[model samples]
Target chain A: MRVLGVDPGLTRCGVGVVEGVAGRPLRMVGVGVVRTPADADVADRLVLIERGIEQWLDEHRPEYVAVERVFSQHNVRTVMGTAQASAVAMLCAARRGLPVALHTPSEVKAAVTGSGRADKAQVGAMVTRLLRLDAPPRPADAADALALAICHIWRAPATNRLQELAAAHRRTPTPVRIPKGTR
Target chain B: MRVLGVDPGLTRCGVGVVEGVAGRPLRMVGVGVVRTPADADVADRLVLIERGIEQWLDEHRPEYVAVERVFSQHNVRTVMGTAQASAVAMLCAARRGLPVALHTPSEVKAAVTGSGRADKAQVGAMVTRLLRLDAPPRPADAADALALAICHIWRAPATNRLQELAAAHRRTPTPVRIPKGTR
Candidate 1:
């Protein structure tokens, strides 16, 4: 399966696409960074992000999307911005009817570098090593994005059997409870 | 002087411009929302934000720009987004040689509602009341943007004077001391 991984940011976003399947090595399809002009307004910056993602999606047409989930909650303003960016990613995948998998930063690092606390430089090195590239990915964001894709490939289940079991449980009927007063 | 206030986001950004001098009643010169398609990429979203800000600057020629400073410590992803968005605003102002001011969320809310802990609804209500508007601004982001302008107007002296002092300090030379070990 082809997977599109995204590292979302307002000014710069890193996107990577990789093709692979279970028990198979993943191959990099494309990787790039989207940059917003420093002088642009917030509105324009957001537009830049959207256009970049669209271009990437059109070129790759990946079957699955893997995005980093927002886990920090320190600054309200920061949290709001992240929420908006995450919402955009979700909307993009949902619009295309592509299944999305959200991965935590630690999980991604752990899968790629064998350590949950791997720094950006370490992660980048590991990605370069794993991809067997001559150099590390330019723009740390892109490397992180690639790592995210590799992470999902390593961790996500091949089949939706677990999901099906959960869904079946959810679909099971519940017996009505009689209120004490009514009884 | 005209001051433009911005509340940056990935999906929607709120922008407002107020025309007046310090201590004078500011009039709303322009206000609007810039939106990005949910399915679009991050780069495209940023472009939209830039275009919206550029359009507003071209139309209004505001002398100064004010933006909210994002300060998230927990969520790295969210913090990165906010930092990117904030960088865009700063760059826009710098490009036009307009001085930019950043206010914290609590500071803006405190200035608008006399309470740092004010909620969005409370801040919105207070902004409407302060502006003598018949209805509250639609989409909380817009109201917050307007509030940021109001805060800048009311607290301009504090910020301006501090900036002046900092500039003066930078210009003044300090005595250099040689370390005893070096000597």
Candidate 2:
């Protein structure tokens, strides 16, 4: 399945698309960054980002969208902006009825390098090697987007299986029986 | 000017519209809450919220949209959700070409109740009095939204002046002089 991976940020949001299924060769469909000037108004920056992502969505038409899940960040301002951008990505995917998956940084790192503590250099190197590119994408964010897409393609089956199991459990809930007792 | 104020949250978002200029009586054009189930998926909830805010913008056609600026909260999850919702409000306003303003909670309280530390009850009472409503609106969120509207109407002029001054300064930047000996 084709997947669009979004590394959402206020000043520079990374967009990458990868197409493949598990145990199959993966191909990089596209890679780019949507940038807004640091001095621009927040609302205006978001509008630009919305337009950029919309354009990417229209061009790529990926079956699934993967976004980096934002954790509680020490810098509140930074985290808030990142979270807002992440939600914008989700909204774009939802508008098109495409299922969206959120992968944490550590999760993506582990899936790509087989280690959760992989550094940016290592992650970038792996992305370059895996995607068979001549050079690692610049500014880390772009490579990170590709990594997120590759991670989702490789790991999503497991997550989907778990979700299916949970849904089945919900459909036919837990059974309870009373102990036999004298009338 | 007419203002649509939004107090954004995940479970229940407050929205209110008020119209008036400085030194004039403010009228509450609308006040209500948009709700989503607490258990709903985050993406789904956000979609619902986007639709709700879009509808409000379409119906009210306010000149300005004001959102409560989210501060750093102890609960990261809660704050992130609020930030996401607030961004949605801003995005809707930006899409419609309506200018957006973000007011801090303390700022709204100070504008409405003459005290930055004013409690919700006091803010609600003042909002009721200011809008000449028959009674204080139900659910503190709705009242807070109206308070935000009033605050934006009352406070925006000064803020606009400051921004204008900054922009004007930028247009014709400060002159630099070098000492005769230094050159």
Candidate 3:
């Protein structure tokens, strides 16, 4: 399966596309970065992001999309902006009817670097080694996007289990089944 | 001075370019919207935003950029993404040596609607009325961007005062003259 991984941000976003299934060596399809100016207005930046995604989708057409879940601490301003950015990504995925998976930072780090707390540099290094790249992906965002794809592959089985459980729950009979004449 | 206002988001971003000086009515030079699919990857979305901003800047060459200062809430996931989007905008503006300003949501709302608690629709309506638009800007995001520009104009005097105070604080006192043999 072709999987596209994204590191979403307002200013700069990193994207990596990989083609393969879980537990198998994935082939790199493409990698790139998108940047917005500090001076550009928010609306313009968002428009740029949308257009870029459209172009990437048109070019790669990946089957699944994986995005890093937003994580914020005490910075309220930062958190709010991040949320808006995340919404854009989710909206994009939903609009296309593509299944989207959100991975936590720790999960991505653990899957890629065998450590949940791995820093950006460490994650980049591991991604390079895993992908057998001649050089590390420029800009930490791109490498993180690749790691996110790797994380999705590692977590896919669990995701399936969760989905199955949800489905089973839905299939379970309601506690109060009424007769046809019942009010 | 030319000011670009942005209402940043993941799916749609509103951009407005206005020109005016202190005590002068701001004239709308241009306005447009950029949209992205909800299902596109985050990286691609950001790339689209960057390119869109670059295109607008190249075309319009605004001297200043103003964006809404995002405020975070309970949605950690969404906030992170917005922060990234804001960063992209800031970077874009900084690259061109264009001064950037951020206004709070309440400030923008109050400036546009005369009420800080106004909803998007209300704010949008007021923006249309204020700008003398034939219709409300499509997708709502555009209207919000225009409102942000209006806010910046309303608040510019206060910002100028702050700058003056800061400048005064930085002025060094004249060096004391030392008599040749007084000591």
Candidate 4:
């Protein structure tokens, strides 16, 4: 499946689109970053990011959107802007009725580099090799976004099976048993 | 001026539309909250919020939007969600070319009540009295939104003057000096 991965940030939002599924060679469809000035009004900056993401979505039309999830509630700084950008990305996907998946930083790292503790450079190098590109994508954020998409594509099959199993369990009601004197 | 105040929240975003100018009778054009389930998918929740805010804007046709500025990054738990909702509100305003204003919690409280540290109930009571409402608006968030609108109306004149001064300075050319013999 074609997937658009978002490494969301207020100042710089990275977007990468990849096409492939499990056990297939992934191809890079698109990659870019949206940058906004710190001096601009917050509303104006947000508008810029929103429009940029919308343009990317319209152009790529990914079947699924994989976003880097913000799982930490520990750090107060940078959370707000990051979350805002993440939400904007998600909104774009939702508007198009695309299935959205979220992967943690560690999950993406492990999926791409086979090590949860792999550094950014390692992940970037893995993304480059996996996509068969001569060079890694420009800007670390862009490379990270590509990694997120690759992670989602590789993990989707297992996730689908788990979801299917859960659905089956839900559909079959538990058998009721009669007590000694109960009808 | 007509102003829409947004109390941004992920689960319950409060929106209030008020019409009037400073030193005039402020009337409530509309008031409501957009709510989504806590268990809903993040993308779906954002889409719900985006649509709700858009509906409010379309229905009210407000000339300006006043959003509560997120100041503290102290609380990591809900800050992300709040900031995301705030961004959504700002995007709606920006899309319509409306001038957006941001007010801090303390500023809103100070504008509504005589003190910056006034409690929510105090702010609500003042909002009711200022708007000549029969009772305080339902939900604290809704009341806070009205207070935000009121704050913007009262503070806008000063903000406008600053903006004007800044714009005027930008328009005038800066002095350029010629070298000693070139003059």
Residue-wise C-alpha lDDT for candidate 1, range B8-86, written one tens digit per residue:
7767788888777666666777778888786654545555666787888899898889988877644565455555455
Q: State residue B170's C-alpha deviation in candidate 4, in Å.
A: 4.7
Order of candidates by DockQ, top first?
2, 4, 3, 1
* Candidate 4 residue lDDT tens string, A87-159: 8888888878887888999999999999999998999899999999999998999999999999999999987
Residue-wise lDDT of candidate 3 within A1-183, one digit each (tens)?
777888877787788887766777777788887676766456566666766766777799978788878767645654554555555565566557677788988999999888899899999888888788988898998998888887887788888689679869878988987799777
Residue-level lDDT for B114 in candidate 4: 79
Candidate 2's residue-wise lDDT over A54-75, tens digit each? 9999999999899999987658
Model 4 has an lDDT value of 0.89
TM-score of each: 0.55, 0.91, 0.56, 0.89
Q: Judging by DockQ against the true structure, name the best candidate.
A: 2
In terms of lDDT, the best-performing candidate is 2
lDDT of 4 at A154: 97
Specify the poorest-scoring 10-residue window by lDDT in model 2 chain B: B39-48
- Candidate 2 lDDT at B124 equals 92
Candidate 1 chain B lDDT trough over 10 residues, lowest sum? B78-87
Docking quality tier of model 3: incorrect
Clashing pairs in 2: none
Give the better candidate number (3 or 4) by DockQ. 4
What do the candidate models score in CA lDDT, each in turn?
Answer: 0.77, 0.90, 0.75, 0.89
